[model samples]
Target: MDLSVTVDDGVALLEMRRPPANHFDEVLIGGIVDAALGLDDDPRCRVIVLASEGRHFCAGADFGGGDFAADHVDAAARLYRRAVRLFEVRTPIVAAVQGTAVGGGLGLACAADFRVAEAGTRFVANFARLGFHQGFGLSVTLPELVGRQKATDMMLTARRVGGEEAYRIGLADRLAEPGRVRETARALALEIAASAPLAVRSMRATLRGDLAGRVRAALDHELAEQRVHWATRDAAEGIAASLARRSPVFTGE
Candidate 1:
């Protein structure tokens, strides 16, 4: 399993164990969904602090070899189903973003109710750079966090937004000192845990009305578009260029 869960002082800590970039796949995302759903029913867990034992929070899918799907199922659809489960869980989440949250990783961070990041933390929405439509429910989560204009800019330009700018743009809810991202996130989780659990759940549900359903709907379109793009020569070129650390030349293919 790529995930572990522990509870302390009404705060549940869900840690992703994949190191380096911490790219996510079906198994990893399913583990998170299962754990979060269990925690939602555990009386001891009032909030969840989502962190990772890695240089980066998550670098999204490892296209080189990462398994985004099972052999029997459609890849992106399966992964997006698990991704939707994150939005359905009742417990609020706080993500500790250390180094970078790129591609679908940015969507994962946005899944959290709050995010704690440091000045140097980089958040990139690089789907266009990769020559694909964004997945992991980013179509809904990104615009919700950073507004439609900023989200459109990020997706189209594929720019890397640092923590300070992220906070300024409402992408990051809080900023911590360097090397203290997880600790600060845990502290914020603890603070939320101090609130009345029932009331908090009620308010959260009210504020997030129809969000999970919207994400589910958005994912269907995202997956369909990605499927079309994946067959394009430009997508092949973009991916090759990215892996080779060079610029891509798209010819409207």
Candidate 2:
């Protein structure tokens, strides 16, 4: 299973079990969406702690992989469809980001209501460097979390933001000691679960009004842009350079 769900008291812990980088594909994202939706319907689950078992929370999609590049447009559309469902869940979520959250991995972290990260945790928006448009609703969620200027800076520059900087810039909601990210996230979730479940969900919904609709609209635009870029020479060069761990040289074409 790509995901595991365990409930304790009113907290549902949804762990992504894919190891090392935890790179996601359609199936993995679908499983996560299904698990979250299932937890949403369970009255016993008042909150969710999104976590991963690996050195990195998620490294994003493996664009170099055959499965991802095949039928790129259709695959992206299907992935976005499932990704949007994450926003529809009523339960509040706290993410434990222990390591690098790059590209769509950062998108997943931003999906949570709160995030707990250690000082070593790194958040990166690397699509521009990859020569593609951002996906996983980052066009909406990135700016929503860190404001338009900061989001643009991260996306365009493709810089890594450590946990301290992330917290200062409003990217990470809470900072944890090294090796305690998941525990801290669970503690925060427990705190949220202590509240009246109905009221908590109601308040969360009010605060996030129309977020799902906005993300859906953003995904359409993002996907269209990505489709165009995917066929470009720069995109190919960028992917090759990344795999080779070198700087990409782009041409106007």
- Alpha-carbon local distance difference test for all models: 0.90, 0.91
User: For residue 200, what is the lDDT in candidate 1?
Assistant: 99
Clashing pairs in 2: none
lDDT of 1 by residue, 1-253 (tens): 5889999999999999999889888889889999999999999999999999979999987776655322212767788888899999999999999999999899899999999999999999998988888888899999989899999999999999999999999999889999999989988998999999999999999999999999999989988898888888888888778878899998879
Highest lDDT model number = 2
lDDT of 1: 0.90
TM-score per candidate, chains pooled: 0.96, 0.98
Best prediction by TM-score:
2
Per-residue lDDT of 39 in model 2 = 89
Over 4 Å off, model 2 = none
In candidate 1, the residue pairs with backbone N, CA or C atoms under 3 Å apart (3 or more residues apart, or in different chains) clash, namely none
